[model samples]
Target: MKKRLIVGISGASGAPIAVELLKALRDTGIESHLIISHGGACTIRQETSLSVEEVQALADKVYAQVDIGAGPASGTWESLGMAIVPCSMKTVAGIWSGYSDNLMLRAADVTLKERKKLVLVARETPMSPIHLRNLQELSMMGAVIMPPVISYYHHPQSPEDITRHLVGKILDQFQIDLPQFCRWEGEPHV
Candidate 1:
């Protein structure tokens, strides 16, 4: 069966990561259920040529950020996992505090409560103690607190290359194998 993944895009600056993740999922024949926050919508327009509609069109299913009634908000809904690419610090805090004000937070909360994989591509830098504590809490709760740290081992040559590498790492946490990028080996390439 095709795996169902919940893709949440928050208002983080790295919108390209979310875009590439969605495209990778589509390319890999996985079903994506997406939720784009208002800030995410703005960042996409600011960062990419693709329109918000074009991005939403890539998903098998799309939910509004405020749609707490969405299937992803229910633990009973069978999904492989959820990934929040370019996860905002605000969203991370919300998840840490069990604040399900929006669908993204609610879905993440559900993913945690259901003991499913929750991958967060956190995007903040020079984080405060609060941020670190929130990440710690989420980590304790089984959420993968991944950041957008790219590896140079693959010899990335472009923005797309970098994005693919990071997305591949995110998918790795979910055990979704895709040929998005090459794994690192500590040997010099000839």
Candidate 2:
């Protein structure tokens, strides 16, 4: 089977990051199986010029959020792992509570049960105790809790640059080196 990865997009502010990640995955020739929540569809409309269909076009395959019987919902579907880019707090809670109400959540649950890497690009600030607790528990359960934190050392000049940097960092978790990602080589020599 070809190298595949499941990408989930939930409602969050960083919809562009998800878009960039999908583009990067396409550029890398990795087959992306995508599942976007209702909120994700809305966010893509509000935050990006491209429609949700355009974004879905970037992936090798797309699954409807309501389709719980999709290929990704099964552990038998081989994949490198799954990344829920711009994961909303609600989605985090759903996954933490083991509530597989939709394909995105079900795929995440399967990723965990299969002992595959599940990266949640948690998008929230000033995380409340409830959110933190959920994240902590999810981490304990072997899911990576990645936030869309910006790095200054890279000297990002625009929002796209920042988004690319963040996407690169997320890709790093899957051991895929994004060519544009500026890695820290240590403190700049004086």
Candidate 3:
């Protein structure tokens, strides 16, 4: 069977990461099922030249946020794992509290209940005590909370480079490899 991955795009600042991740998955022959929150769509419009439909077109399948009956909302759906790139604080809180108000949250909840890999790329600045606590709760609940911080050791030359490194790392969690990923050999060298 083809490897299936569910990708969620939350309303966070780093819309570029989602686009890169989608492009990488598409190139690698991974059938991606994408879910985009309303805020996610708004952010895409704000940050990217690609329209919402254009972004949706990146995935093999796309589901509405309110579609509770979608395939990803169930545990029986055969998927490798799920990810919420640029996961917003609201989205984070929803998953941390098991709030299945939308398909993204429901899919994440299902992923957690089924013990599948659920990667959350939380993007926020100067995390408050509440953010830290919520993130801690998510970590304790078996979710990998990635903040998308830059790894300066890679000697990134452009915005695209940083985005690729982070996207590659996210895909790495699902055992998905992309050659564009800057793999850290050991120590930084000139």
TM-score of each: 0.95, 0.97, 0.96
Error of 3 at 53 (Å): 0.7
> Candidate 3: what lDDT?
0.92
- Best prediction by TM-score: 2
RMSD per candidate (Å) reads 1.6, 1.0, 1.5
All candidates in order of TM-score, best leading: 2, 3, 1
In model 2, the runs with Cα more than 4 Å from the true position are none
Sort every candidate by lDDT, greatest first: 2, 3, 1
User: TM-score: which is higher, 1 or 3?
Assistant: 3
* Candidate maximizing lDDT: 2
| TM-score: the better of candidates 2 and 3 | 2
Q: What is the C-alpha lDDT of each candidate?
A: 0.90, 0.93, 0.92
Candidate 1: list runs displaced more than 4 Å. 188-190
lDDT of 1 by residue, 1-190 (tens): 2499999999998999888889888998889999999999999999999999999999999999878998999988989989998899999999999989999999999999999999999889899999899998899999998999978888899988888888889888877786846986668778
Model 2's TM-score against the true structure: 0.97
